[model samples]
Target: MLPYKNEGEIRRLEGLADQNKLTNEQRTELTKLRNERKAHEIQVAALFDKDTAKLHSELEKIDLKASKPMTVSTTEPI
Candidate 1:
């Protein structure tokens, strides 16, 4: 029996070929789907980077606050 991994890969390739069948309509549809998916991935990456930058900036502010010495009240002894 073929290994499961090999079987899965073969099946996946077959599905790809089937999806990209020789008909012009199938080809066009495949191209459209692929392009849309690529565009979506780019948009997601940009958003992720923007969010990462914002989080890093916030963390830096927090770290700065943490590094400063705090004043203790005269009534309170450490």
Candidate 2:
């Protein structure tokens, strides 16, 4: 997922750069949006890490289950 809140902050900053009038509440809103985006990014990365670990664990179990025992053959002397 993209960081929409961050994008909004960028837009707001651009407006500020253009000298657009902004209320105090709008400034606070922009700060809140940026913080929320950061938090969301952290959450998404953590979830990805968890999922990757789970997949690796599952693959290891599959490898363990799919392994075969070694066999030896004996021949009589002719």
Candidate 3:
């Protein structure tokens, strides 16, 4: 998923499966890889949700400040 370098073994196994020629070992490996992919997907999604929530919180704080009235001070430069 992160896209480093893989040897395309999954594709090889799938191709073999299409022909109904996959070995037992290959089937096990494919299942393991599929499960790992699911776990990675879940972890990435959780992180994204957390970051989104923090961003929304910060935006809300800024919005609240903006909604308040501003007062001018004589000591402040125009």
Q: Give the best candidate by TM-score.
A: 3
lDDT against true structure, model 2: 0.74
Clashing pairs in 2: none
Which candidate, 2 or 3, has the higher TM-score? 3
Instruction: Please identify which of the two predictions, 1 or 2, would achieve the higher lDDT against the true structure.
Output: 2
Give the runs in model 2 whose Cα sits over 4 Å from its true position: 1-20, 69-78
How would you encode candidate 2's per-residue C-alpha lDDT over 24-47 as one tens digit per residue?
877777777778778888898898
Error of 1 at 30 (Å): 0.6
* Candidate 3's TM-score: 0.66
Q: TM-score, each model?
A: 0.62, 0.60, 0.66
Question: All models: lDDT?
Answer: 0.64, 0.74, 0.77
Worst 10 residues of 1 by lDDT: 1-10
> Alpha carbon lDDT of residue 56, candidate 2?
100
Q: Which has the higher lDDT value, candidate number 2 or candidate number 3?
A: 3
Q: Which stretches of candidate 1 lie over 4 Å from their true place?
A: 1-22, 71-78
